[model samples]
Target chain A: MQIFHRSTNTISRATIFGAVFVVAALFWVAATVQRSPYVTYAGVARPQPAPFSHQHHVAGLGIDCRYCHTSVETSSFAGIPPTKTCMNCHSQIWTNAAMLEPVRESYRSGKSLVWNRVNDLPDFVYFNHSIHINKGVGCNTCHGPVDRMPLMYNYASLQMEWCLDCHRAPEKYLRPREQVFNMRYQEPSSSQPVLVDGQPYTDQLSLGMDLVKKYKLRTATDIMSCSTCHR
Target chain B: MRNCRKISLLGALMLLLAGCRQDMHDQPRFKPLAESDFYADLRSARTPVEGTVARGQLHEDTYFYTGKIGNNPGDFMPFPVTEEVLARGRERFDIFCAPCHSRLGDGNGFVPSRGFPRKPPSYHSERLRKAPLGYFFDVISNGFGIMPDYASQIPARDRWCIIAYVRALQLSQNATMADVPSGEKVPSELPRFEEPGSGATLPVVEPKSANSAPEEPK
Candidate 1:
């Protein structure tokens, strides 16, 4: 050990101290990168076969979500619209448009047009759309402002922590069952008090709390149990 | 440099571990409507084999399924209509039928407005207003002229529910105040719009309270 100069001790100590900071910074970078759009694809729009605009269909055309997503209220999978649903109006309205050629071809060939999945979840998560819909959870609560999305994108990080935030306290986001499909639904406010059973609520907490009781939502502890989503 | 060799070997091991990180997140089984390479069609969801029926899908009640008695459309609902039934009917109708047949059942819906070629007939018209409940149900199950069949999309029970709502709309357009029963209010409270709760704490707003709102500017 004496073969090295006394200055080596100082250098060694500085290196040791710097390693702690370097490790911390590396961990911080790792976490930052994990949650970033690059990893989670949260705000990024995935390419689809066609540039179908939810903004135009939902907001512009005033089409209800259930019109195309028929089994949303009954099944775990929000049934994707078959080629027939697109042809419902497109068959008459935009029959010759070049943009709709894929849809037209799918109809003629009797082959399904494979639309890209935008909000795919890991296979481990057993999320049920019908249960959430029945429990008075708004579609926008998780899907975000779908009426404003020109091209579909995942609005939230589909992470466990993101899901647990709602599972821990669902009352914070619960809306009336009727407002579940309404993308333009607003939270309770003094100016626009939400009426439930003819009893107007001026605050979201009071309204949500009431909805929790009325909807018979399971306790936070029960929903928070790992099995709730994992199974 | 033996140390250098050891470090390089460690790095190789780490790279091997990283490359093997494909388990758990996506398991072996397919998700709903996922693409499958195993099948020629590339569809994970397969249709039921021909002439085979799943459990509970026998469709025992012929009237409920077809909305017909012996070939002609029947004149009744499969079940008694309730406030809840009508509420569900209205919700379902607004989703499925209102595009071409407007929410008002006036054939002035957004789809028709956008040149849907054939405007759906108004439910309020004499020909449609007099149409039996089963007739409407038949039209929904089997496609009417220019309209596609909705049998696959809407369940049988919901078809009946929609027919009930359509009848309600028909009566609403031609109804007089006298049609309401005595002592019962005209423009009754829509029980569905009531705020969610146990519904035990407060009664619905009285008719007078609703009428007491400030009048619209002339």
Candidate 2:
């Protein structure tokens, strides 16, 4: 009738309960950690039709971001370069390489190579590349050293909280207009004054604040509002 | 019996939790260019009603939009070229045109050098140097040969700026010593040598050939 004869040496009820609780807690922790963007998205390079190396193109050759993502400043989407853009170089440089067969096929067939999206946001979020780019948010701030990426991956969490963190205080992330595309641009030390139009502004905070005012940026409250992104 | 019931209940709870995903990604929507039976044209996207123009899209200036005066390409820019305009043009050209035409307008851009079918004609060429401002604009608006039209990517004003910058580049490459301003001095030769006080020495690199004899370090 009994599953096992209860003996004095058998495991205690308290110990069994404690063991179950620990197992459940550990399982929950493991699940939560796996779902975190750091584990799930960041540093995980999605496979692409072409093994394009941003490191070789952007860092090695000093090709500009706008050269490939042609509509970064003009459109909501940072447009992917067409096959012709690839042929503009590949048709000559590595003409017979096996690696570029897909690129050549895409060009010949007039079908776009489906590049896997690395930095995918949920369909609901209305992110605008032009507004962020033109407003002085550096590409590095969100993309996290794309020039050095051999294969591109999602760099930021793209979570609501992560977005609100920047939306709430954009000044910290702001860079000079020219340095927006400079992947290696460093934030000036607090003691070092950044000279803008011959006037020295001490530190990045003051410079960012001055830029915010100059650029006529909306305050955190307005930017962080639900409709600002959700719509 | 109690243990069996408990295990079953826990498994059922887990299964229930697994089924509770909010499917926001599966929302009903018409995809771009997706066929729709609701429309008579069998298209999800409806064509603009006859001659209906969207607000702020009324292109009143024909010359600005078309880059032509009647049938001929206009000889002049729609707006006066300024320092700001040229700067804007340079930025846009470097982004859009420089990939093929090159930063120097030499037709030896990274793209063409790699393996493109045809290299674009250099702006410094005599034919292009003599090309009217509108001719460049027309080429940009209506693509010439394999070059795609950039009308959608570049605005009319930016196109004009690109033309101005191209002209500036043409002038720069073809300039004589007299073209230099009175106060500014043109260097007789390009400064080739590095400064003596640079302090950095070039690292002695070995030849990659396995059979080559190693040389003593300088």
For candidate 1, the lDDT comes to 0.84
Where does model 2 exceed 4 Å of error? Answer: A1-39, A88-95, A190-195, A200-202, B1-22, B30-62, B115-119, B143-149, B176-182, B185-218
Put down candidate 1 lDDT per residue, A133-165, tens digits, no spaces. Answer: 999998989999988899999999998899999
* Candidates in order, interface RMSD in Å: 10.0, 15.9
What class would a CAPRI assessor give candidate 2's docking? incorrect
lDDT tens digits by residue: candidate 2, B1-218: 99999999999999977866646643456543444678654556565788999887899999998888898888898888898899889878877787778779999866666556778888999899998888899999888876777876678889999999999999999999889989776763333222221111112232333344232111
Tell me the tens digit of each residue's lDDT in model 2 across A43-70: 8888999899987787666577876777
Candidate 1 CAPRI category: acceptable
lDDT string, candidate 1, B1-218, tens digits: 99999999999999978966756777999888888999887888999999999999998899999989999999998999998789889888888898778779999887778767678889899999888899989899889888888988899999999999999998988999888789977786543323442111122332323235322110
Best by TM-score: 1
Clashing pairs in 1: A196-B195, A196-B196, A197-B194, A197-B195, A197-B196, A198-B195
